[model samples]
Target: MAALISTTDTEAQSSGDPSSKRGGWITFPFLMATLLGLSITSFGWVMNLIVFLIEEYNIKNIAAAQISNIVNGCFSMLPVVTAILADSFFGNIPVISASAFISFLGIFLLTLITSFDYLRPKPCETGSILCQSPSKLQLGILYAALALVTTGTAGTRVTLASAGANQYEKPKDKGSFFNWYFLTVNTGAIISATAIVYTQDNASWKLGFGICAAANLISFFVFISGKRYYKHDKPMKSPFTSLVRVVVAATVKRKAVISSKEEDYHHNELIEEAMPSKSFRFLNRAALKVEGDLKLSGDDSFNNIWRLCSVQEVEDFKAVLRLIPLWLAIMLVSTPIVVQASMMILQGLVTDRGLGPHFKVPAGSLQVITIISACIVIIINNWLVYPMYQKLTNKPLTPLQKVGIGQVFTILSMAISAVVESKRLKTVGNEHPMSVLWLFPPLVIVGIGEAFQLPANTELFYGEFPESLRNTATSLTSVVIGISFYLSTALIDVIQRTTAWLPDDINHGRVDNVYWVLVIGGVLNLGYFLVCCWLYKYRNLKNDDQEQDP
Candidate 1:
């Protein structure tokens, strides 16, 4: 009875509880969302910590970077599976619940293994006749732990986070929902990146895992707790049954077209408003077909163009298919963001910072730098960028524009990191210690880029994709990111081997060359982004299959 408050375990029942109205203090819905956001953010820190510990065992930096890919790759691939089920079979709530449970198990196991400190350097005696260690089993446990969290993360955070946000009332409360949603998420990031980073380094691994687990469990409870506040956001019926039938009936025009024009009046207005791009023309023509001669009221107009698209017409499919290229573009941009989890960590360790006891720079500390950067960026966006954008352009930045801007920052940040890396290299043998402060500047730049990019990207991806396909779109973005991480691993290997870039002594544990890898990556990404900007220009609002462009 307690858990049954929501229709399904995942969705909060939409019953008009007294708690539904937003007033004085934080509403239950927003509070729950905040907690969930924090949980997921902390989980990210947990994953980072786990990978770092595994890396610590090996003397080789490149191997550690490659090992980090295991989580990224699996999350990217596995989510597609969960998202498909979520969109088609299970629905978002159940997928979220199931993911949490999976994550719970993964973290518990990881905590148990870490409690034993299995990965810590094993005691070795001088010629003590081959000391045997039982750490391999623990290592396997560690990987499995990561997989569970990643799998849960894919569903709960990746697939359902925005979906969770969307279940609220829209058009009116939309901005508020996003406000709390984005703010809560960044809040979580700020905490996890700082507290989690600090605790993991200063405290034992168990403490770190336990903190994360506690946070995650709190998130699980909060989501379930507010079962009374959330509106039920069920998936549309399966394509095999209801959706397919709806498509067929519409295509055959047998179900009666009715006065759907009024229902779609907003769409027409949008078409009229679009720029004269090919996509706009395409949208206009297709819309014109749908609305053959706006003169004929309803049924007559429909019958006139009734046969235009059969149930499986090529053009209909193509209209739906057009969404793919844009989706791919958004997904590709997300790659660098997700890949940063491991890559940034490696960069922090190796970069030579001039200030030390001056600052006490630690190897795994660079991961925190991004967090600091993210906070700075997050602040500027909410306080400065979004407002300035409104004033400067008169028209607010579109989601696409926001993403484009972020890409530009991503290019610049990468370039700066590369330059810093090059600078650090020049000082390698010199008396100057690479001041950790130098890392801060590049990190802040990347953070600003992330601020500009991620939230807007998230909104655009989910909003632009048809409601039924949101989960799949989210998963696809993740997949693009996963591929990027794998590429990061490959780049690390190549850089480590081919070049005499890293100092040999610090080479294994230190990612001295990691910055170089980021430098090259930034150059390539910048070039790719330029091409995207050019191609993206031709797309018009009318041509888009969905998205009621402003």
Candidate 2:
């Protein structure tokens, strides 16, 4: 998604009018408003979905968690596909508009499902022997609603982020926009996780989903209203084809000796003076000039794309390759968090949720703590921590350093979760259960980690990739998150099948052991991330003050 914005800016600059009236801070308010509405709508339904499945659809606790993970996986993964559509066929406006409408329809359907009794299974107590599973027809309708919601939400998430950032030309302003972007998002999540989830738990699911539907509909209109203020970019030919050509050209010329002379390599007008970097020298063959590689017309264009590529194209592909290790490490760091999100709900259900005699905390609302924590952390980082660090060190925190801090917090969160779960297991049979507050420490830590990692990752990827490939770079984080959620689902399934540690009833299972495993994995992932950071060379350094290593 970040890539889409960069592509738009690059196109604007190439057109010799970088200061066009189509984009600037003037568009900021509208984009932020649209994002806020969408955020409220998205989180309103998603945060409580596990509970919805368990209570309305009569799903098993573990099955509901797995379903929740799969849904989240889709939420993260679909952005990549939609981003391509925005970049290749439809521009961001059409894609975002259509997606928001689709999201409204999905949420509206969910509202209908909650209103009608026949649309879901008969209500039953959690873990009851007489609880009935949803019939095939009911399940089908439910799944259809979920599918629409997932697709619609996925399309809008990253697209909106990209669109918002596209309004600003300067990198510093872009960075500030991201900070506020996430703050707005987390603020909306806080509303949904508290107000919306509370409505569902205490008032009526129909009304709660109705609110979500209205928010989505309103957000669609809000986005449409701002259409005139946006800096719209025309859809470009898919950049991926050129990347593939580079790989193909390199393979075809594998036996060709790599050239040191700049004249022997093909260079586009934009980079005529640029020579191939010494690293990955074999890939330089892709740009090496050979007899018959050029067309007889004497134009710069190659006769065969599979046999020859420009130097820029080769380097673009190499940039992607270099990012792979860090990408995997970050993905691994996120997987445990995915696991924790689902598992926390299960833990909350068994714990004492009574805030007072008048009110009880909803299990789903436990996630709000993490959201609030992340929001607070973001505020502190922006106002105090970052300024203080720069004052003392004479440099702002680099994205890689922020990511490393996130990894450390991730490990800490997992260890804390393990300790909390172990203590909770011991008090399982007590007349008074453990307070739900016990879950707060780990959840808050997870939020803090998110505050550091997610934005830093976006900044890192957006800054490092080639301008031609920038459209794909930001979407890489979404891909990582999507894969992480799927991997979390797989891990849970594997645990359930092979070990007694995760039985149907969590009260009798060893969830602490699961957290311990995640803790170990988090440590290993941190080490791997550090190594990647050390080895990586920044291709698009924003400033000399930024450090090269984490």
Candidate 3:
């Protein structure tokens, strides 16, 4: 580790020389450009997807939302697999570049679907009693496009963050890069949600999808062009494999007596000597250097499986075990957020979207309110709220505390959503359309909750997890989102089949009841979260102070 740090410092010093080939800020633009182009391409289709399904394909609104949820879930989840591949096999640049090409192909195929007639179902005649559903062939083509796009977006999204952070050795520069990365992401989202949605709604689907395809194509090349300037990390075997190995080895040697002496464990020469934590004592058997477990006198002749492991390996596995409950609790927190996002689009469809006499807002674009609010809140919280709190209290709010505050806001948002939805239902009678602005308060509240929870949740994982599992740690947020989305899909399906609350036509159904369910669920989940927070101890409490660096 010292040698690695020395090399990085040397590279940093040499970066000032005009002739140096590596290590500087020159790669930032390339990453930003790649991110911007990809975000535009991904969000262009995703944000407006429900509208497209309802308008062009004539699918039921509820079904369309479910499909969107599934796609979003896939989009979120695929990053886990990709991040693992980057960290354990292929590394970041290759995975990102390959994903970019896949994305381009996906969007390009979508453009083709829009430009051609046979690729999609025939347009339903106005006020037709029986609209023609898309054929199996058409559905197959569409799903293929969605799969490629989801996989592509997932691969590139988080991997780029890792790649960018690798360029800088200092924590401060890395933190600053992350801030700008998120800002670029939001910027791309706003543009795609507004401009691209408007183009698809008012102009032509072909043109809009074409623009997305073109952007993706450009992004692929942009990333490849910067390959020479970027710093690259070599892929190594995943720590997850070692964790699993420890479990298997410990179980095989269950009858073996554990040892109290430090010398009884196989300590890696490179790592400093330390006793294993007593919390998960059973796993300590995995590291016990019993007779025949090692060949200390020989070269490359030691038990590799079902026998022994290094002391560090056992503790790493235990750290992961400790985090599982907290991870599961947070999954519940995200489920309602996913459910609300899916439902909000449907609500916007029914609400009066007119801004004035001449302008009307697109239903799909309503999410921009949430996006804009979250960005603003993130800025304000970091720049004003946190500092002020620290000044007043003489100590900063811990990550867990921040997340707990987020839980409160989440509960409030759900309650607010339920009330607003009830009001909208009441006003929908007598041909009265509730103003779309009614959706803003809940969305803004949820956004504030995100600002609090997301950073804390991310920091907790990154700070607490084993160093070898850093890639996996950062990707955990994506995993939660993915699982929550799938859970939300299942929840919506159960609601549709088991209750009258979520019919195809929400006007005839009790949509407000669903929000009430979320409110109750949010409260329960918040309770679960608080309990987890109480039980959880930070593995690196001092390291967390560095996490606050700007």
Candidate 4:
């Protein structure tokens, strides 16, 4: 991955220069600050979106959750498109800058909507007979704001990570950056989930959204201020096109005889002595020398890319294909967590959330437990657990091992949630409702799972993917999360329509059954993940280990 750094860094280092104007630790503060601001702004609204819809729009509990899931999906999915654009056309800085401004615009619009009575439905008590839904014009304005916010958030999310990682030339430095990056993100989330949410609940929604808008504008400027100091990767032609070419070339030359000789296969100067791997022999045909395949003058380039591809290109496509099963398995694991998040909010609403005589926890702020737990787990793993494990085993845990451990935690969290919800149900109408403290254990467990899964998955993808797809690689986890959120929405809808397990009023529904179902799904996902881990081979394990070694 360090090899992906620009040649300027290498040249400066070789010249024994202590100061490189391009990129180094100097860019750290600016990038971290930018991330912190963005995280705070984005989470302010995202964490409380379901409640906002239910309270402000007169949306039913189930419908509000569904809308939240779709919003979450957009938050994750649009990044892949932005990442592709960054890697192929605009580069990261430009895309991030544009997106940040867009976010500001959206949040500002949200603030306006909150401040004005005309922009939302009339406020009505939950389950009221005369609840009024928003008119089409009002809905249109709200959707347009959400669209802008979602697009901006998705565009900046993964692209910023890739850009930050690009600034460092060492793997250890890159790893440290990611660690700090997530910490900063969680810290921002903590602020948003707690302080901002409290303000929204107790003070004013307009003020909370105003703060978010201000943060977005400030972060955009902070990012722009570092423009000259950052190391920028120039955009190249779309690498996705090359992957398609490999597939097309292989299909075109399907009947070509497999070659034993080295010269018969196409090789660029970088892999001149490399032989095609036997793992995916059929793909090797794409790089085989065949009739009418023309070579350009004095270079390894091919004139007809559709008919002939380099061996490296074929291998890159194979790497992507090999990742599918593991990706799907992880997506399944994440789906349950997504469902649990929305469920937690609904559960908190009907439970006792009092912390003391004068204070009550905002339902949306319950997610802070997860973020706080993840932060603590990350700190411990970085400073204690990972070091001890590496010393005892003579090698650190692989990303796959971390993911497996996370899957177990995920299952445990689901089971715990089911038990807690069951207990809550028993006391639903009693003089004393179930205390929100019971929600802590499951939330913390899921946070620990995330600490293991999210970073490990990001590291795995970034390390193994082809260099050309580095930005896209970073966004792969986002793609999984996006799809999982969508799946969670679909699953919730099915459950609502198919059974009495998830009625519009969760108080009347068996919410524990939903958690139990997630537990079963999580166990199945874990099984699938383990199988994929057993069968899959790392393309760059040795290099990755050396780079990751502390």
TM-score, every prediction: 0.71, 0.92, 0.93, 0.92
Q: Which candidate gets the maximum lDDT versus the true structure?
A: 4
**Tens digits of per-residue lDDT for model 4 on 64-173?**
99999999999989999998899889999999999999998899999999999999988996666679999999999999999998899888998888899989999999
lDDT at position 322, candidate 3: 85
Which is superior by lDDT, 1 or 3?
A: 3
Given candidate 2, what's the lDDT at residue 259?
74
Candidate 3: give the clashing pairs.
Answer: none
Candidate 3 has a TM-score of 0.93
Using lDDT as the measure, name the better of candidate 2 and candidate 4: 4
Q: Give the better candidate number (1 or 2) by lDDT.
A: 2
Model 1 vs truth, CA RMSD: 7.9
Off by over 4 Å in 3: 1-20, 295-306, 543-550
1 or 2, greater by TM-score: 2
* Candidate 2 structure quality by residue, lDDT tens digits, 1-550: 5456666666666797757556788778888888888899889998999999988888999999999999989998999899989988898889999999998889999999999999988888666588878999998988899899889989988788788788888899988898788778888898999999999999999999999899888888888886766887689888798988888888888889887788998878776548888878888988998876766555555467777888888888888889889888999999999999999999999999998899889999999998888878977998999899999998788889999998899889999999999999999889999999999999999999998998799888989888876877788888889999899999999999988888868999999999999999988888888888888878766675454785
RMSD of each: 7.9, 4.6, 4.7, 4.9
Which candidate leads in TM-score? Answer: 3
**Worst window of 10 by summed lDDT in candidate 4:** 541-550
Error of 2 at 198 (Å): 0.3
